[model samples]
Target: MASSESSLFSMAGDSYSKYEIRRRNPNPTAAALLVIDMQRHFASIAAPILPALRSTVALCRAAGIPVLFTRHRHRSPADYAMLGEWWSGDLILDGTPAAELLPDIGRDPGDRVVEKSTYSAFAGTGLEEALRGMGVEEVIVTGVMTNLCCETSAREAFVRGFRVFFSTDATATSNKDLHEATLKNMAYGFAYLVDCKRLEAALAPKI
Candidate 1:
């Protein structure tokens, strides 16, 4: 293939690229913020992005947008067969510190907390129902493991007919390349990509 043809095919495969999805402000009533797998294990490696994550959460709260947090939990060894042998030891056991959300972040008593064992929050959890119950049509996603849990949840949300806004800075992976790759992929086709700062400004109360 000619160089231009190759370039065209490459760009065609990417849906999250800026040239593909022009960034737009989310419609107010349709949007809610979804914080996925922001527990201790992931949060520890994401310490650098803590400030940005916190700010995003606060902005959503102030805007009266529903904020949902997902906690990954799995069964113990005795009951783990149902969850799969591959997850036996790697699971985030219920009530364990590793499964707990970071306390320093904003989490109100009334905020919805959904426990999920799988990568996609909507797979086994009531996250979709909860969002629907609240009349939410758009999801602003942020959290850990940009290429894993976060990306999975965002894609699921999109397939379920919700507009997904994925925060670039509020998510982190074990390596920068994986993180960037996930963002690029999601932003190109799966979700709307926004940095924490832009999202915060968008959610800020009009003066």
Candidate 2:
């Protein structure tokens, strides 16, 4: 990677920060870490944040915060929805290697993995129910495509009553503009923006 994951935070300068109104840390006990679409199809865009994403998963696990992952793939044309038309069917098919989650995300046997065909994990995947069942009131969103799946999931989580913590560095997109746009959108209305260092401090053990 040309730029380290920590450097991704430098993009969240005055423009993005100006939209931030509420600055609050996450409640670990009531929070779950959401790893969204960290699959092979998005390897290029996801590579820069893999280190930070792995660290985030480890930190949440250490803090006893349950971790959930979302995998996006179209089983068939029937499940493609608007995605098939939008990208002219340049979609991830279910049986392909691209549909598989990156093995390095530190996903464990007991961690919940939700499969969906759309941008928002909660759209038809029952992710909201799963989170509620786990007694999770807060979600820390991290993974590939900051302006797509990650951002959509974070916004959906917010509307569905979960306090969202959107990671600035642990999430990435095709370009800096889309990534920064999502950060600003999150800070403005949907979620509180967070970075790896902030998460470290928030999830640090109390004396």
The candidate maximizing lDDT is 2
Per-residue lDDT tens digits for candidate 2, residues 78-97, read: 98778888866468889888
Whole-model lDDT values for every prediction:
0.72, 0.83
Instruction: Please report the TM-score between candidate 2 and the true structure.
Output: 0.91
Q: TM-score per candidate, in order?
A: 0.83, 0.91
Shift in Å, residue 73, candidate 1: 0.6
lDDT of 1 by residue, 16-97 (tens): 3442355866656789988877777665455766777788888787787878888877655554454556544466778877
Q: Global lDDT for candidate 2? A: 0.83
Residue 151 of candidate 1: its Cα lDDT? 87
Residue pairs in candidate 2 whose N, alpha carbon or C atoms collide under 3 angstroms: none
Over 4 Å off, model 2: 1-19
True-vs-predicted CA distance for residue 23, candidate 1, Å: 0.7
Between which residue pairs do clashes occur in model 1?
Answer: 15-188, 15-189, 16-187, 16-188, 16-189, 17-188
